[model samples]
Target: MQQACTGDRFFTFYLLDGFALHGFSAAVEALRLANDVAGRPVYDWLAVTADGQPAVSSCGMRIAADRSLAEERDRLLRVAPPRCIVVCGGRMAPPPDRALEAWLRLCGRNRLALGSFASGLYPLARAGLTDGRRCAVHWEHFPDFSERFFTAKARQTAFEIDGSLYTCAGGNAPFDLFLRLIEADLGTDTVNRICEIALRERLRETGERQRLPLQARLGTDNAFLIRVIEQMEANLSEPLRLTALSPASGLSRRQMERLFRREMGRTPARYYLDLRLERAHLLLLTASQPIIEIAMACGFSTASHFSRTYRERYGCTPQQTRLAETARRRAGGRGNAPEMEHERHVA
Candidate 1:
């Protein structure tokens, strides 16, 4: 159904528990600037929580709700409901919300432009709204999201839009998505002005990578070394042999070994092991996949070997990492998880 004689395009943002304040604020500010530049309210929005109370962000900030999910569902029956209903999410994977899922199903049938970003996309994907649609989630949560939502064609890009559904990976990625919305409704000129007002350098186009380039990350301009690392990331699950990786760099094993030690401060084998362990660490904290599965996914042939090696490097078993994260979340995601720094230090 078409919007009922709506002068301004309206949006209803249903902010989930522990939603990312950065992305949510970016979206609101983008619309506010669009109205400022256009000399009128080209867009209108309302922020709501699950139960009509203020939402707590991942960083522990409280955002007041304009309405509740129940209220928003009732409003959908009235004339000119929001042109889009965006779900804001945070670092935590959302638990099952039957009400939200059912409401999302209704949104899909209503032909409303549904939107979500970060871990928030879980509900849309879980609700079956993203079936056969392209979607993106934050890189930190990508492993879990991809494993869980096979029906949704998941991408590691900044954002994805298939017909009326728009999904973004978390952080500043959603800023680009919201700017594209403004450009669609207003024009390129309006979007440019909005970016200027927001002090944004430029709008990141869709399909751009959610992660920094390998060159930037490694802080090295050695093309051969970078190529080797690229292959390592691409083949994390099965893992490429050092002999095979040497061919990627056109170097003898000894030459490549020196390169790894010089640049990364670790032997090639140690570096490869660390890379795989880093991925496992992330999966352990953010996902609930079984230990054996996680071990295999990270190229560990056995869970015992994975556990022993994990303990040697991180000073705890994989089980401990997951348990600590669960404890932190139960504590309402307040302070950082003790093992979080270990993962962050991964090169």
Candidate 2:
């Protein structure tokens, strides 16, 4: 890591087509505000693209790059390289071009720190940069990312910093990340001033959770029920028997069943089964794992049983769901697989 200095640090943002506009604005705006308040250039940034042409954002805004990938690559060989390079991507970002992927590999070889925002992590992961690293990805993309990159550790946090690699779940998360970076490079006073100028009420720490708690989302105050559901979520790969949950919840089997029936309108066993099946469904759509492996991961004793339960709930076989997802990706449309919409949390 480079020592924090009073001199300006250069940053390069690689914007991909369909990149989130808010994420780009938040990052650059923070640095812009920091320089404004300091009355000097504490940070410098350049926007770049693969071919040096304008990139279109998800919201249909066009952004012109300051340079092309080739130009930046040549410049890196001649001058002091950027302190950091961040890839900003959109929801439907396509797989990176081979030229861009090779350029990222060159950056890695030069020991330049790299980072990503939103679905930009997808390209980094595809380029093998995120392997064995903890990355924060939007909840909407977690399933697909996990399925595609089994070796990478994905977290549902606001942002993550592993070594020189930084990533965030997108939206205003880039603001939090950039603020933290500004604080580390300058000081808390500068960060606070920038936040005030930006009209932010509070600066969210990187450790703050990105997802709302399930209890709050469900609008329930039943602590016991919440605990039971948490346990079930934690034990999805190896479901607990109803009798075993008694000790964990400090409630008898009958009591737990009654609570589940009253609160969720389902038996405890049925609810647990549904949880596992739902997990399996997500794995089917998001990951390329085999049906049998997904079945085992979901704690089903056999693939037949998993398929039977899946068919009953979703009215389609797991293979059919995977195929549909594959077709959707090929067609450039949102996948046909059903998502647990309520489970999603904004970045």
Candidate 3:
């Protein structure tokens, strides 16, 4: 990590198409408040886009950029560079942008800190910037991120700070990440005041899991049942048999069956099948992995079996889902995948 600098820390926000506005806002707001709380500009930031024009947000809002990638690169050459460069992304990962990838690599060569949110991490991963680095990926996108970037140590945590790289899961997770960064820069006293001003209840540390526990998500506090679900999630690629799961849950096979049916309103086998199908559905919509490969990854023996099961669960085949998503992207509903508004940075 670079030595922490005092005075002002300048940041550049590289906004990608279909970027999540909330994540970007959360980060900037933290720094904005830091300045207010400190009675000076402790932190400063600017927005940048590929064309130096306004960038559109995921929710259809537009934010004007302060400069273009080329302009920023020129500034990096002629002037002091930003303290950090952040990539902001939305729900879907856009297509690769060659120009953006080069810019990010340049940042790395310059030893500048790099940051990203949600699918924005894709660009960093593709540019080889996140290789062997710890990254925090939103749980909804964790499967695709990990599958595509095996070298990056992807975690389902709120955020991760590994060396010069910073990553945050999408949504409100950015608030926690930015707060930590602020705390690092200004100290605990200032952070506490900032939180009070923002009406934030507490500070969340690193290594916090991104998702709710299965027990909470399912509206049940049964420890044994939750343990079995965790096991199921961990072994999705090669499902465990009821006999194996029964021992782990401390219930006989028959007892497990009764418990699942009563609490979940489904047989244990049925519940397990649904879990696999749910994972398969998300991958089908968001990933480019071949149907057969997805089926195998989800533990189906054959593509035919996988397609049949998928159709029953989703009311459409995997191919159909892929086609629809393609059409949607082409129609500009999704602004096409992975575009950085022509500069092609991560996200």
TM-score each candidate.
Answer: 0.90, 0.76, 0.90
Candidate 1 versus truth, CA RMSD in Å, comes to: 6.3
Best by lDDT: 3
Q: What is candidate 1's TM-score against the reference? A: 0.90
lDDT of 1 by residue, 1-347 (tens): 01222237878888888788899888877877888899986777777778887777776667767678887788788766788999999887888999999999998898889999788899999899888888887877877788788888889999987889999887888789999988988899989998888899989987889888899998999988998998898888899999999977799999998999899999989989999999999888767789899999889999889999999999999888888888876665777533221000000
Q: lDDT per residue, candidate 3, 152-268, as tens digits? A: 999999999998899998898888888888888889998899889999998888878988878789999988888888899998879999899999899999989989998999998
RMSD of each: 6.3, 7.0, 5.2
Error of 3 at 212 (Å): 1.1
lDDT of 1 at 149: 88
Candidate 3 structure lDDT: 0.84
Q: Write the per-residue lDDT of candidate 2 for residues 1-347, one digit (tens) a residue.
A: 11222437878889887688899889988888888888887788877888887776665556767788898889889888898999998665356478878888888888999999888888788888899998998875675687678898898888998888999989898999989888898899998898888889888876567888998876898988888888998888889888878778888888998999998999999999998898888777645557998898889989899999999999999989988766655533434333221111111
Per-residue error at 228 for model 1, in Å? 1.1
How far residue 206's Cα lies from its native spot in candidate 3, in Å, is 0.9
